[model samples]
Target: MILRSQRPLKLKAAFICDISLETFVSIIKTAYSYFTLLLYIAN
Candidate 1:
Protein backbone atom coordinates (compact mmCIF):
# COMPACT_ATOMS: atom_id res chain seq x y z
CA MET A 1 0.00 0.00 0.00
CA ILE A 2 2.80 2.39 0.82
CA LEU A 3 4.64 1.55 -2.39
CA ARG A 4 1.46 1.97 -4.40
CA SER A 5 0.90 5.44 -2.99
CA GLN A 6 4.54 6.45 -3.36
CA ARG A 7 4.86 5.25 -6.96
CA PRO A 8 2.69 8.04 -8.33
CA LEU A 9 4.57 10.62 -6.29
CA LYS A 10 7.86 9.34 -7.63
CA LEU A 11 6.59 9.63 -11.17
CA LYS A 12 5.21 13.07 -10.49
CA ALA A 13 8.51 14.16 -9.02
CA ALA A 14 10.34 13.24 -12.22
CA PHE A 15 7.76 15.10 -14.28
CA ILE A 16 7.88 18.06 -11.95
CA CYS A 17 11.62 18.36 -12.36
CA ASP A 18 11.19 18.37 -16.12
CA ILE A 19 8.69 21.25 -16.02
CA SER A 20 8.78 24.74 -14.56
CA LEU A 21 8.15 25.04 -10.83
CA GLU A 22 5.05 27.18 -11.21
CA THR A 23 3.35 24.78 -13.64
CA PHE A 24 4.34 21.77 -11.57
CA VAL A 25 2.85 23.35 -8.44
CA SER A 26 -0.32 24.20 -10.34
CA ILE A 27 -0.66 20.62 -11.54
CA ILE A 28 -0.16 19.31 -8.03
CA LYS A 29 -2.73 21.74 -6.63
CA THR A 30 -5.24 20.77 -9.33
CA ALA A 31 -4.80 17.08 -8.61
CA TYR A 32 -4.95 17.64 -4.88
CA SER A 33 -8.23 19.54 -5.20
CA TYR A 34 -9.72 16.77 -7.30
CA PHE A 35 -8.66 14.17 -4.76
CA THR A 36 -10.12 16.29 -1.98
CA LEU A 37 -13.41 16.55 -3.83
CA LEU A 38 -13.56 12.81 -4.24
CA LEU A 39 -12.94 12.28 -0.56
CA TYR A 40 -15.54 14.90 0.34
CA ILE A 41 -18.10 13.08 -1.77
CA ALA A 42 -17.09 9.72 -0.31
CA ASN A 43 -17.41 10.98 3.24
Candidate 2:
Protein backbone atom coordinates (compact mmCIF):
# COMPACT_ATOMS: atom_id res chain seq x y z
CA MET A 1 0.00 0.00 0.00
CA ILE A 2 1.06 3.62 -0.50
CA LEU A 3 1.06 4.24 3.21
CA ARG A 4 3.50 1.40 3.80
CA SER A 5 5.91 2.78 1.20
CA GLN A 6 5.63 6.28 2.64
CA ARG A 7 6.41 5.02 6.11
CA PRO A 8 9.90 3.89 5.14
CA LEU A 9 10.59 7.16 3.34
CA LYS A 10 9.57 9.13 6.41
CA LEU A 11 11.84 7.03 8.60
CA LYS A 12 14.74 7.52 6.22
CA ALA A 13 14.21 11.26 6.22
CA ALA A 14 14.14 11.35 9.97
CA PHE A 15 17.33 9.34 10.18
CA ILE A 16 19.10 11.65 7.77
CA CYS A 17 17.95 14.68 9.70
CA ASP A 18 19.28 13.19 12.93
CA ILE A 19 22.65 12.42 11.33
CA SER A 20 22.99 15.95 9.98
CA LEU A 21 22.13 17.47 13.31
CA GLU A 22 24.71 15.32 15.07
CA THR A 23 27.34 16.27 12.53
CA PHE A 24 26.57 19.95 12.95
CA VAL A 25 26.81 19.68 16.71
CA SER A 26 30.11 17.81 16.52
CA ILE A 27 31.57 20.42 14.20
CA ILE A 28 30.56 23.22 16.51
CA LYS A 29 32.08 21.47 19.47
CA THR A 30 35.35 20.84 17.64
CA ALA A 31 35.58 24.47 16.58
CA TYR A 32 34.89 25.64 20.09
CA SER A 33 37.57 23.39 21.52
CA TYR A 34 40.08 24.55 18.96
CA PHE A 35 39.30 28.19 19.72
CA THR A 36 39.72 27.61 23.38
CA LEU A 37 43.04 25.88 22.85
CA LEU A 38 44.30 28.74 20.75
CA LEU A 39 43.30 31.24 23.39
CA TYR A 40 45.03 29.22 26.04
CA ILE A 41 48.21 29.03 23.98
CA ALA A 42 48.15 32.76 23.33
CA ASN A 43 47.82 33.55 26.99
* Best TM-score among the predictions, by candidate number: 1
* lDDT per residue (tens digit) for residues 1-43 in model 1: 8878664442246555455567778998999999999999999
Predictions: Cα RMSD each: 10.3, 8.1
**Candidate 2 minimal-lDDT segment of 10 residues:** 7-16
Off by over 4 Å in 2: 1-19
Candidate 2 lDDT tens digits, 3-36: 7866433223445553445566677899999999
Model 1 accuracy (lDDT, Cα): 0.73
Clash count, one per candidate: 0, 0
TM-score of 2: 0.56
Residue 22 local lDDT, model 1: 71
Residue 15, model 2: Cα distance from true site in angstroms: 20
- TM-scores for every candidate against the unseen true structure: 0.57, 0.56
Q: Cα miss at 12, model 2 (Å)?
A: 17
Count clashing pairs, candidate 2: 0
